[model samples]
Target: MVTLEQSQPKAGERAYAQLLDEIQSGALPAGTVLAEMEQAARLHVSRTPLREALRRLVADGLVVQQSPRVTVVAPIDAHDIRALFEMRRALEESAARIAAERGDAARFAALADELTAARLDGETGRDAYYDLISRFDVELDRAVANDYIASALRTVRAHLVRVRRMARDRPERLTASVAEHLLIARALAARDGDLAAHATHVHLHNALASILANLENEGSA
Candidate 1:
C-alpha cells in the first residue's frame, strides 16, 4: 500500500479528499484505472496511505477494487441513475426537514449565496456550477445536523455526480436547476420544515424525471 509523509493533512483524509475531488470532477472518469503506484508517486505519498484513501472511496461508492488492479471508479448505467435519484429524493427530503427544524439561518444563507454565485457563473457559460452544487450539498447537510443522514446523502451524491452532470450540464437545464435550488434554500431560510421538505422532494423528482428522459433519449438514438 502507498503511504504519504505529508504532515499538513490527515493521511487518509487528505488522500480521500484529493481522490474524491478528482472523481467528482470527472478527472478520473468511471472505469479509469487508478494505479496505486502511479497515484502514490503522483501524489507524493506512500502506497500505504494511498490504499487507505482508496478504501475510503470504496466506502463512499466512488471506486471498486478488483484483484490484479488497484481500483477504478465503478461504471454506472441507466438503472444506477434512477436508483441514485430515488435515494436522493428520500434522503434530501429528510435532510431538508431536519435542517428546517435544527439548522440556523446563517447556514441556509450561505447555501443560497453559493447557488446564486453558481447561477451567475453558469449563465455566463462558466463551469463553476458543479463546484457550487457541491458547496450547496455540504451546507444543506450541515443544516441537517445529523451525521448519519449527512453520510447517507453524501454517499448517494457521490455516485450521482456524473449522472447529475449528464442532466445538469446543459445550458438551459443548468440555469433552471440553480433556480430550483434557490427555492429550497429560501424555504429552509424561513425555517419551514414542511415547506423545505416538500420543495426539496418536488425538485428532486423533477430532476430525476429530466435525467430519465435524457438517458432514454440517449439510449434510443
Candidate 2:
C-alpha cells in the first residue's frame, strides 16, 4: 500500500514497512527467500537500502539470516503464538487496570459505543474494526501515561499482525471479540480497575484459544 514516491526521503524505512506488511499479510509466507538483488529491483530501491531494510526485519524477528547471503521470513506456529500471548496478557492486563484508574470515562464510554456498533461483514468492515481498536489503544496508552509500557506495546503489536492474520476468519470469533472489547471499554468507563483488568485477561484468554484452535484445524486440513 506504500508508494515509492512517498518513500523517497527514507527509502530504507519505506522498504522495511512495505516488506513487513507483505510478510504479515502472508503475501511472503514463512521461509520465503528475500534475495537482496531481486527484492531491490522489485521494490525499485538500491542494494544498500534493501540491505538496511532486511537488517531491520531481522531485528524485528520477522526475518532471519540463514547465511551471509540468504534471508528468509521467519516461521510462525503454536509455540510462538503462546509465547506472544503470555507477554500480551501481562502487558494488556496491567494497561487495562491503569487505564481504568486514570483514563477519562467519557472517552472510553465513546469507544464502547463504537464497538457496540462495529460491523465485520467484509474486508472494509474488518479494516474499520481494526481502526477502532487502534484508536482504543491510543486512548489506553494516553490514559496509562507510561512511556515504557507504550514502547513495549508497540513491539508486541508489530508481531501480532501475523498472529492475528493466522487466526483466520471466523464470524463467531469476530463477534465475540467485539463484545469482549465492549466489556473492557465499559469497565474502563466505570473506573473499575479490577473489572477492566479481568475483562482484558478473559479477552486475551479467549483469543489465544481461538487462534490455537484455528492453527490446529489448518494443520489437520
Candidate 3:
C-alpha cells in the first residue's frame, strides 16, 4: 500500500519504491508491460526517472526487458519459489544461530511473548502480525551485525513480499508460521544456537511445502 507522492524528492527513488511495491503486491502482475510514457505519467515522474526506476527493477530481477522499448514484470513460478527458499534456508538458519549466540536475550523473550499473543483474525490483525515479524527481522539483523549477511537478506526479502502475498489467504499456514517463529524466538531467548537454527530449518521446510502445495492447487484450478 505504498502511496506515490508527486512531491517526493529523488524522483527516481520515489518512482522505484512505488513501482516495486505495486509489483510485489501483485497490483502490477506478471507480464504487465511498463510503457515508459504510460508509467511516467501514472507515477507523475518524467521519462528519465521512470527509466531509472525500471533499470533498478531489472537489476532486482522483478522486471525484465522484453525489448528495448518494453519492460514487463517478471513471472514467478514454483521453481523460482523453491530457489528463493533455498537461499532463505541457508541465510536465515545461519542468522538465527548467530542471533541466538550473540543477540539480546530479553528482546527475543519479549518478541516470543508478542508472538504468543498475536491475533490474525482479520486484515488489520494480519497487518499487525506481519509488522511484528518485520520488527523481529530487524532485531535479528541487528544481532547478527554482519553487513554482508544483512545485505543479502535485504535482496531475498524484496522478492519474498510477493511470495508472502501468495499465501495471504491461507489462515492455517499463517497461524503455523507464527508458532514456528515463536519457537525460534524462544530458542534465541534461551541462547540456544543449535535449537534456533533447527527451528529455522523446520520453519522454512514447512513454508516451502505449503507454498508449493498452494501453487500446484492453483495450477490445477
Best by TM-score: 3
Per-residue CA lDDT of candidate 3, range 141-204, in tens?
9999999999999889999999998788999999999999999999999999999999999999
Model 2, global lDDT: 0.92
TM-score per prediction, in order, is: 0.80, 0.93, 0.95
Every candidate's lDDT: 0.78, 0.92, 0.94
lDDT at 158 for candidate 2? 80
How well is each residue in 1-221 modelled by candidate 1, as lDDT tens digits? 54335542476677888888888778888899999889988887777878889988888778998775768888877788878878888888888888888778777777787777664444344457666667777777777778888878767877776776677556666677888888888888888889888888878877877888887888899
Where in model 2 is the C-alpha error above 4 Å?
A: 1-9
- Winner on TM-score (2 vs 3): 3
* Candidate 3 global lDDT: 0.94
Sum up the clashes in candidate 2.
Answer: 0
Model 3 / residue 132 / CA error / Å:
0.9
Clashes of 1: 11
**Model 3 per-residue lDDT at 198:** 97
Ranking by TM-score, best first? Answer: 3, 2, 1
